[model samples]
Target: MEWDIAKKDFKRYLLLERNLSNHSIDAYLNDVQKLEAYCSFKKTALAQVDARFIQQFLVFINDFSISAFTQARLLSGLRTFFAFLQIEYDRKDNPTELVESPRLNRKIPTVLNIEEIDALIAAIDLSTLEGMRNKTILEVLYGCGLRVSELVTLKVSNLYLDVEFVKVEGKGSKERLIPIGHHAIKYLKIYLEEVRPHVPVQMGHEDVVFLNRRGKQLTRVMVFLIIKDLAKKIGLTKPISPHTFRHSFASHLVEGGADLRAVQDMLGHESITTTEIYTHIDKDYLQSVITQYHPRS
Candidate 1:
């Protein structure tokens, strides 16, 4: 019942039984680590920890001023862990079962308008090899609405340029084929034909679609930095990351009257509700159309 052993077993359960992705498993383990740290600070053992101990840990985390969404996610992780302990280990009780998550505000995601997206891309030099790769990266990110991790892990074999679709290995290793736009395909062809061929491929990364200067797979951090630099270069006031293009992609599609289910499939969202957020982002467009065309308006 030691914290270390408990975390290891929980991770195994998540991997083997739940079949969660590494990103999700890491998040759950991070929550457990937080609890373990709190327990250490209080000189308490896992076996002796109770609901009160969990509540105290919440208070400790609250002092750090994390967002409500983050707090809720952490609590969800803790609840899952304690439930696993109760069911699998035959623990008498679950400490986090009754613990409530923080009330979450529906914060709208930041989305770039078509003009902003264009401006960002237009700012790229496209003269150097890295610039060409960066342009392709932005094009694919916006065109396919890919997650940063998916973009990094994208392989050459998965691309079906003839059919204009790329097989994306999404969350939980789920595979979905997303149609690539003409612009994305055009830039990808240029990068592949003109730039990427010049770089020597590393041993294990021969098939990786994007690579670092060293001929290795590009890291997620590298992608973030690239986007950050571009945003700064263009004097974009709103903070943005790689995910901004994804949000923008969905928003623009919804505004253009794309079906929610179709957008959901494209984005690899397991739930329609996650895709529904794009509808909210398109509310202004919906209202404008109604106001102009509807007799009642």
Candidate 2:
């Protein structure tokens, strides 16, 4: 089939069979479209494309100075798209099955210390409506370890605040229950009760947990901007984003003696190894533990 026809088939599988959300279906299609873009540029087509061509594209991405992470994601996305094709059309095997992803070097993400987190939260003045919402946003994000997308899409029905847990649909549309702290829950109640009712919401987003001044759902960029503004206000010199809270959430738990596997489950990570990458060991804290419990010192 031509690439356009193949794309339509993939789109149907994603929407009807897989029952993916519009956002998710769009993303998966966009991934496949990247390959199509490459083919168009090179005056080739997907049906005639081969593994070596894919490899060349990977190298070409590097030549254009694409980040290894971006390169890896594009390859992984293509791999899944081809896998989906293999299932739909039983005539051919997947070419991407044995292809290597971009060689990625692991780097520990920057984390917010407990004190810095407190400062960031404190910087949110609770007098204005936006302040209340901002405070609530920061608390819930750090408390629940939510991705920006998850936070923006959160609905009133998903919150089981009475039970100290909230249901979050994460990447790949995976659902997980994450624990919320009492402090976070407290501020969230305040925002829900006081500020949220005041915002002028659009028709479809009334049930959304967070809202802008106009009562519409927040964009990912809004979350990013919120965090950036908070960082500037608090004189935070390190790089950060909405994802910083997630990194801090996992890191703080590990540092507080939470089991690595437990952290993995809470973070909704597919592998413990991915979760392990978030740990930031404080040598002074480690030494303090040893000093207090040494048999002979």
Query: What's the distance in Å from true for residue 39, model 1?
Result: 5.3
Across residues 1-297, which tens digit of lDDT does each residue of candidate 2 receive? 688888899889888777677887787788788778888999996767778888887787778898888888878778877887778766276667667887788888988888999999999888899999999999988998888889999989999999999998887687999889999999999989988888998999978999988879999999899889989998999999999999999888888889998889888888878998867687678998889999874
- Provide backbone clash counts, one per model: 0, 0
Residue 193 shift from truth in candidate 2, angstroms = 3.1
Worst 10 residues of 1 by lDDT: 277-286
- 123-163 per-residue lDDT for model 1 (tens digits): 89988899999999999999999999999999999999999
> Least lDDT summed over 10 consecutive residues: which range in candidate 2?
89-98
Listing every candidate in turn, what is its Cα RMSD in Å to the true structure after a full C-alpha superposition? 3.4, 3.7
TM-score of each: 0.82, 0.80
Q: Candidate 1, overall lDDT?
A: 0.91
Tell me the spans in candidate 2 whose CA falls farther than 4 Å from its real position. 16-50, 60-62, 172-174, 197-203, 283-297
lDDT of candidates 1 onward, in order: 0.91, 0.86
Q: Report how far residue 6 has shifted in candidate 2, in Å.
A: 2.8
Best by TM-score: 1
